[model samples]
Target: MDLIGHVRCFVAVAEERHFGRAAARLGMAQPPLSQRMQRLERELGVRLFDRSSRQVTITRSGALLLEEARALLDRSEEFLACATRIKDGQSGLLRAALPSGLARETVAAILADLHQHHPSVELELEELSTTDQLARLASHDLEVGLIHHPCDVAGLELGPVLRCELGVLLPRASLLAARDEVPLASLTGLGLVLFPRADAPAVYDDLLTTCARNGYTPDSLRHGQGDSFVHGLILSVNAVAFSPPDRGTAAGSPSSEVVWRPLAGAPLAWRYSVAWPHGRKDTAIHAFADAVPRALWNTAAVSTDPPPRPLHLRPASEYWL
Candidate 1:
């Protein structure tokens, strides 16, 4: 047996204090493990395990060897992980774009997970609107997109669709802010702040359609881009805006200026998906996609067959707005 394998067997037996348990842990038979340990002790010219009818105990030399073996195993694991990260085509950069107004913890959590799994992967993140993300993805300029659902771009597959319900972000002074839940119709007379209809049609259309379906429509929606900007309008003005639910607005200890209230009557839910272009089959893209947790998402994939003919797709011109 190699030195590492011998050391592994010794460490497992020492820790388990039973040859049977150590063999089970190692997925080996008892006889081979016992033989391996004996060989290791003979090679070292010192006894490691003191065995009797009832029990097995580590000797003085075994205790000290245990510490060194564990350290060596840990270093070996790190070395193997380093090789895996940089060996395959995974050792490159992944350029990603994310839309604003996502749940506060979304980006940080994803980045943290990616770092842990693939330390060699370098990430470049951009805060582009869903529209821009679609455009860049089509041209192969961007590798991954954390975007809103209902993305209509061709040649890209959507996946791990996450459900994010919406809440009303209202100023503290508004009458509706005092209620635990705000009725959909309560927003009828209030000013509404929205992303430009073109930027995120899925979100914009869904917001308007849900409101209209429930017998209430905003008289006029002032177009704005960016979650922070829309939120600013809500905070400083007597306006209502769509916000992701449960992010310190609706719960106890509401913010000083803005309060979150769930939209009652019609279910207000939005979806998010991690998008990547099809047929590219890039390792880094798949790695990033795999790193995202599946707990909160329902994945969907479009076909890999290329579109038949050349067709014009929408350019992300509104990205600057």
Candidate 2:
């Protein structure tokens, strides 16, 4: 019955104290406004107004309910305003994720940036591998993700691509550490310490293929997930791990007994971008996307340039002719 709307009509007519004047104020004809007031009165089982040919006066009952009616309309307006803010992404809980293997400092910086810009938004962050992120994003369980390249992005909208060049991380005692840069071919006899294939299948395959093409096939592939674990493998197993450049201290340094050196030709690079489900980008998602590049650049020293080639291509296996 649009009871609130009837109350609005009643309030206007009561305050104006004349049917024609109230109708003019409400931008409606006098007949309809009067009819609505009568309906409102019947619905409430109370006579709300005393109407004569020329004048209108509010009944005692109408005066008694007027303040309550005003309060209800005020609350309704407030409710709609709040819903609009949520729809616009100005306030809400945003579920987001980041791939593992990111430096702790990088993650902290990203969180700080998001908070500074979106103080009203509550970001629920998760640490997930690229493979797990893809599955959750597909199922609509995640709202946004920062994902590595060479992964399937079939139904997602991606942000600007950023690249961090990969270097060799080896025991500083190794002979190869003496070189200004290590060529892939130089590490032929060493095992390759890497994350598991399941972490990111396409990236894993691509890394192996590039290494093989460059004449450095590892003696074995060792899997490790944490920095300490991966570093432990490199030191104990006489192997090398590919890593991003660090400032001579954090990523296996003088005290850590490991060192990071650039590749001779920069054969491998990590590319990543913030992504969300197609058609689901909102204000909060955009805020997160906007914060990522700056955070990566400031903390991880990543380059914001677009990669030379596309990140992924659908496998030909799906074709049926």
Q: Which candidate leads the pack in TM-score?
A: 2
Tens-digit lDDT track of model 1 for 1-321: 598899999999999999999999999999999899999998999899999978999999999889999999999888788677655547767798777655445566667777877777888888888888888888878888877655575677755565566777787777887898888877776778877767776666655766766756776568775656776777665578776654534332544567677788536665666788886566677767766544233222112222221122233322221
- Per lDDT, the best of the predicted structures is 2
Estimate the TM-score of every prediction: 0.61, 0.84
Please write out the lDDT profile of model 2 over residues 184-236, one tens digit for every residue. Answer: 99998899888887988887877787788798888888898778888899889
Off by over 4 Å in 1: 1-88, 225-228, 235-237, 246-255, 294-321
Give the Cα-based TM-score of candidate 2 against the true structure: 0.84
User: How many steric overlaps are in each model, in order?
Assistant: 3, 0
Model 1: worst 10 consecutive residues (lDDT sum): 301-310
Off by over 4 Å in 2: 42-64, 246-249, 305-308, 314-321
